[model samples]
Target chain A: MGRKLLLEHINVPGINTLEVYRKTGGYRAVEKAIKTMSTDEVVEEVKKSGLRGRGGAGFPTGMKWSFLAKPEGVARYLVCNADESEPGTFKDRYLMTNIPHALIEGMIVSSYALGANTSYIYVRGEMMPQIRILEKAIAEAKAAGFLGKNILGSGYDLELYVQPGGGAYICGEETALLESLEGKRGNPRIKPPFPAIAGLYGCPTVVNNVESIAAVVPIINDGGEEYAKIGIGRSTGTKLISASGNINKPGVYEIELGVSVEDFIYSEEYCGGIANGKRLKAVVAGGSSVPILPANLILNLVNGDKRLMSYESLSEGGFTTGTMLGSGGFVVLDEDQCIVRNTWNFSRFYHHESCGQCSPCREGTGWMEKVLHRLENGHGKMSDMDLLVDVSKKIEGNTICPLGDAAAWPVASAIRHFRDEFEWHVRNPTLAVKENFGLAHYADPLPELVS
Target chain B: MLKVEETQSVEFSTELVNKFAEIVSRYPEGKEKSALLPILHEVQAVNGWLSSVAMDKVAAYLNIAPIEVYEVASFYSMYFLRPQGKFVLEVCRTGPCCLVGAEKIIDYIGEKLGVKEGEVTADGLFSYRGVECLAACGFAPVLQIGPEYTFYENLTTNSVDQLISDLKDKASKS
Candidate 1:
């Protein structure tokens, strides 16, 4: 097994409770940072660790923190993005539901580093149980002198609260999250002021993903040098990959970065290969928003190099022949699955969650969904394929938020990689409605249950 | 719509008022309006859903305009504008779940409950709607009900039938 930083103690009984978590060496990071280390020291160590944001964007966490503007007497804030609504990405929910204290401990250290006295975790409202657990954990931390005034005999003080969103996927974007936190609609703001400069009611704020914040505890505990030695060159840490879709052992598994895609899929330790001995057709390696890769492209690159699950390796072809590791959602599709139907499902999601801020996104998403619906159900013409490409291109970079690109990329990628399937639907309109594009070279025939 | 709307004089229970105060205290001194989301949640829990009257009370409690509350409430998928069944079944219909059999499960819940999407059953016991990803893709075909969002994962037609029966039994006793 690789070094499991975040999930090392995940299966420990009562780990959710404060007393049990404390017994398991929790909150040591807070003591370490608050007692011996300076704010710059903590930030410097994280920078050395090369820890990128685990929340899709993969921005460097330390760089993001250093950008926090410290205007005289202006209070800065650290907001945790717990709105884990991205399809196929559930690692945050698992981390919070099972080990609530990890996030709390990390939040305290992260807050101290940024010189913020107040922080809020904006969790998706649907996750009420996890929110309750976090609230309990926060109360326990406050009672134990880790939070609230003068923590651990240090002169620093921080107050953290759990804020619930009204359940909009667009709120996962940092600015929209800030807007939602301020009790407004979840509309993403235009950037240049970037939350690090002016956020959360005109004060500087830093919003980090739930996994990224929790990963800081381990970074502080082991020291950044040691943490940097765990994963490959750039991907210098363990990542929690949420394995789902047609897999035997489908759940969150912590793997060292740069593990070969072949090993991650076929090895018994990770996904335990495809389910029911079926052949793999395609895999949305990251979350739904990333480009979907066919099974062949996933195992080997266009350059004939074996593919590794690293940022550099995954995006080698740059949205043309390769996909990014966007949140490590790892959704696998078997041969029997229909790409058109799956693309339609994602289009419907974008349409339902467009936020209606920009006309390109708001209107383009609905049109794409309608077109994809026609394409999926066999009521499409040849021009509909070109129409899909055109619409997705229009929505790609024309919006204030990445939600537009999110809606567009999957449709574009689906057509780019699987054009024959889309054509098959139009050619055999009646047959397409009655049947799926079955295992035609995409699926490898199996002799046994184990892939 | 409870008395929060008609009379403009009805007050929330003492316990709920205290709870709201405690939550509002988490924000900055004058920014208690940040507690609007949680307060709206409490309003929905106390009342079946957020009526105009309930929203007006929430607006008054937060000292913000009712339009602010309405804009926010309408933006989120969680808030219900009208009365729903005692139990709202929100099934995931996004990509990962659909790859596994979420669409079938959504249909199964609809047929068994005799309710179309967003419609409450005649007995006022069940309401079904399809939702975006619930972030539980590993266990596809997941549904959750509010107040706690209790998740029912790896669902099938048979399981949906059993869940409907279980909720019906609970509703009948209440």
Candidate 2:
């Protein structure tokens, strides 16, 4: 059903190779933009397309591009953030591994628009296989004249390299990524001189997420207005939702924006409902960093309006009642899952990845993890619930990078929505260790568990 | 306990040297320090782990201080501070994976290997550790063996034993 834009030819045979990709209208976007469109035209087209950044922030892409400082005799850069380390988000890995050329093609067009002669795709180091896949595709593109000097004889030149991050999720933050790109510790830099003004080696830079960059090909092919018309309102173009956890079909699905949340989870064409006929309890609509919503809030607004999967709709009530479409990492949880245990697990992840840069983030994340660990293991106090919220609130918006807030949102929201479940853990410590708190009020009119 | 002092001159093969040169060239002139991450990858691939010698050699090659190489290498989780076994089983233990029995998967690897997590077997054939999300949660209970870059998905306790045996077989052959 829905119109597929980014992943139209995803399953085509040999699409991974440059030859097959080129046959299926792969590099045409490059040719059209380079030979026909001016650099300003390309930038203006993206602005008109209403394309927002897919890297979780949802900032306008064209505005981010236009911010690049074009200082005289200075170089600018386009670094693709391929560090797909956000838990439950594998779309970037899926894209780069299966259809590498689309990213390569998009990189060429985007590099031209930013007037950057060199670009780097900073992929997480764990995806070594993906790095190899991209390296092969880049070499293939270079030999075909899509890369290197005077590409397609349009007088624009670009060189793209696939750099590996040494396994730190903080590096996914653009400034931290640039620091790691320069072979330093992955501590994030402060603002004012945003990456657009002073980045990598003190040169102006534009670091876009992998999907954001790859989506450029489709926008150029369809024209800005045409591309903008596909998705509902400001959530223009298609988005790759990587669905996992308690879903019958857990994989990446490229859905046109504005698909209803209920349809995406219940329809056979998408997630095909919860696995094993289990009742849905909670779902992290975005990645692990975003707030987790119980089934009631995820499916409907407070005013009983049916919720759709768009930037505006998902975040309707802000952090209190709604969550983000962050990174499109749709993780679903069924009735049998324990919110306390799950929150504890994510708290530990944030603690492990704190980067030790800021006092609040470095200290607060660790304290949250330790306290949550106590609560999950049945040693929690009734006061520990409030302590968790207090610690989470302190870390949010206090660090140089969003990782601190990313750590805080899940814990804070879980306690906000599921205070009863957390309270039960403290009350029934022995039973909590032996069994999960179960669905409770997570799913309204809860269906009986199948098994 | 972690090795840092060098004992001998560290050298790269001609092919590796050429690859390093190509990587360095990607950065601007005098910005060769940016090649530190990839060069460390190359060194680890060649020498098994980054000994003080290899790191100092990377530092000398980049014209940066050796401390620059050490601090950067230690901050990242991928670089082995010690020489791990031939097969490093990095199990994804984040929320999604844990929801699908990742805790049991990791526990099984540790029990079967007869070593604690992060400790190599005496034979140096395998090492196991619980790592954070590898972003492949759709196939939950996943593990990656590096620097071979192979992923084992949907793992059970029995499959883990079979995996360890298969890796042992391959390790003996190579």
lDDT of 2 at A117: 97
List fnat per candidate, in order. 0.89, 0.84
Root-mean-square deviation of Cα positions for candidate 1 versus the true structure, in angstroms: 3.2
Residue A150 local lDDT, model 2 = 96
**Model 1 misplaced stretches (Cα beyond 4 Å):** A443-451, B1-11
lDDT of 1 at A88: 95
Clashing residue pairs, backbone N/CA/C < 3 A, model 1: none
Task: Please tell me the TM-score of chain B in candidate 1 relative to the true structure's chain B.
Answer: 0.92
Cα error of candidate 1 at position A131, Å? 0.5
Instruction: Give chain B TM-scores in order.
Output: 0.92, 0.93
Q: What are the per-model DockQ values?
A: 0.86, 0.85
The collision pairs in model 2 are none
Chain A TM-score of candidate 1 vs. true chain A: 0.97
Interface root-mean-square deviation of model 1 in angstroms is 0.7
- Report how closely model 2 matches the true complex, as a DockQ value: 0.85
**Model 1 chain A poorest ten-residue lDDT run:** A442-451
